[model samples]
Target: MPFYIRARTYFKYAEEQMSLAEKEKDPEKILKFTLEAAERAVRALWAIVQVEAPKEKPPLEKILAEIDKACEPDLAEEIKNHVRRIKELAQNPSVEAAKEALILSRQVVRRTREVLEPIIGPAKRVDQHRRFYF
Candidate 1:
């Protein structure tokens, strides 16, 4: 099966297990289901990274986490700069800087999407897009 399908199946099973655990009030069952969900999500992302990234990179989750951490501050800085640039450009609009900023913003989005896709699936991917777009 495709990684996405497999991930979804595991997620379904985990959700069912969690529901059962809730009904039974069994803590162990809750832990089991939670672990299963995390494992399946990690596995799915690992598969995607295998396909999308070059070899010699770190493991998928580690790399993703590191990249995510690294990007957080940069993204914040970019947003701040963007606001300033937009205001400045409003007064003295520099097409070149705006274009460069736009390009960098796209790169951030693309990198984030690559890290997020297998973990969250399509609906969440769309949600992320919407969240970031606005």
Candidate 2:
């Protein structure tokens, strides 16, 4: 998919996952949704550079590859770092980890918007509420 459609698709999924995560009472379920949100946000970033995310372990590498694929300058390293946390959250699910994942996922989506919107058209404003943790 191209930037306009790809970014919008994944970004919307990310927001929805975050919403579910916030409402979850079980720590594992919270982590599950938070990880999905983060993964979808990273997918949106990949869309920005017109790169497909690698389907495998090491989500950080999956996200970071987009930086080189398009040779896009000014790719934020922090997004990759956040991906690391997201991957770790998968291994060790907890309320705190889910909260961190939620925050990091939002950052990835926000940063992706900064780049994606200008190239593909405007990104719709998604809700920016912080997910309340258990």
Candidate 3:
């Protein structure tokens, strides 16, 4: 599968997990789902970066460094900070931590899309009035 497709799949899973976490009454379940969602979002960002630079499957640290160079300094720093915080939250789960993870996951996904749009062009749109003549 293509990198973008993989990224989309992971992003979708992250969104689903976040939704599940929101509805969950049990704190433990919420934490579990939120953490998973955060992790998946990170993976999606990784895949997006991979699509931008496809020479070799470099180590994650190297890939992150490449992404840092490719993106604005503030955006790169935000992503790095989010990843670090998400990992820390994973280690010690809490309702607040889960919420933070979900928020950061969303930020990462938005940033990734911003970075990818230029390289991949805009995403396709479906319209009811549009028809294929061919």
The local distance difference test score of model 2 is 0.69
lDDT of each: 0.41, 0.69, 0.67
lDDT of 3 by residue, 1-134 (tens): 68778677777787688778778876567767766676666566677656554666455456456556446878877877876777677787777877776677667756765666654445344233465777
Best by lDDT: 2
**Cα-based TM-score, every candidate:** 0.32, 0.68, 0.61
Report lDDT (Cα) of residue 1, candidate 3. 67
In model 1, which residue pairs have backbone atoms overlapping below 3 Å?
A: none
Off by over 4 Å in 2: 51-60, 68-75, 119-134
- Candidate 3 steric clashes: 0
Each prediction's total of clashing residue pairs, residues at least 3 apart in sequence or on different chains, is: 0, 0, 0
The alpha-carbon lDDT assigned to residue 75 of candidate 1 equals 51
> What is the C-alpha lDDT profile of model 2 across 55-117, one tens digit per residue?
453454655765555324545566667777777877887778777777776776667666666
lDDT tens digits by residue: candidate 1, 18-103: 34434533334433433333333333334443434344535434633433232355653443343344334334334454344334
Q: Lowest summed-lDDT stretch of 10 residues in model 2?
A: 123-132
Ranking by TM-score: 2, 3, 1
